[model samples]
Target: MLLCFALSRCAVSPTGDKLYITNLYEDKLLTLARDGTLLATFKDPALDGPYGLYVTPAGQVLVCERLSFSKLQMDSEDRSKLATLATRERDGVRYPMSVCYSSTTTSIIVGQWVNDNILVFRVE
Candidate 1:
């Protein structure tokens, strides 16, 4: 299927061979080859309105769930493991629209779109 709307953010794999895209309207994540070949589509109820996407050095895919204001992490290759790292109401996240994992600092940064703030959390 062609990605037409709500294509929020994208990230390239550490190896630069794959592309990961977040579709907010469709509530799914798309994996594509470097040559734009469709590889896989990941859809889950927990993945509501995914916006920003980041590929960590360890090959973890981090996604920002816009409407939910949550951060989700999954295995980049297969998305076998999915976890909610944070939430707005419980974790002080307010409308998170973007996310990035810092290997050097061992932390995750979330961009709070509506609240106009940035939240940083140290990862263990």
Candidate 2:
């Protein structure tokens, strides 16, 4: 799908039908149908420099905010102020540049870009 704004990150819904795209420049999350129709826009909890995103089995959205443009560390302790933050789990690990739930493995594999390794977490 052609994004009016550069798509910094995107995550397919668990149903594999919808998509949530993060527009870094616009600081907005655009929800789109499978056919690329704009469904809704969310504000307030605006994402900053969002890099990676994923949808959980329970249908919750997860966004990885890359602090300082490319750094993986948390920008702040509060997390909300940090440039790199996970919107879903409070205790979610850091530097999750990529994530995927594998049915075969039954685990959530998190790709740490800078770390150059995949962290596998069992998903019940």
TM-score of 1: 0.87
lDDT of 1 at 85: 79
Error of 2 at 44 (Å): 4.6
Q: Which of the numbered candidates is closest to the native, going by highest lDDT?
A: 1
RMSD of 1: 2.3
lDDT of 1 by residue, 50-113 (tens): 8888888877788888644333344445554356778766787667877888888999998878
In model 1, the runs with Cα more than 4 Å from the true position are 67-77
**Candidate 2 — which residues are off by over 4 angstroms?**
1-5, 14-17, 44-46, 56-59, 67-94
Q: Pick by TM-score: which candidate is best?
A: 1
**How high is the lDDT of residue 110 in model 1?**
86
Q: What is each predicted model's overall lDDT from 0 to 1?
A: 0.77, 0.57
Candidate 2 lDDT for residue 113: 60
lDDT of 2 by residue, 1-124 (tens): 4466667778777787778777766665667788988777654354565666666666656565543121121111222222332333453455556766677887766676666656666655
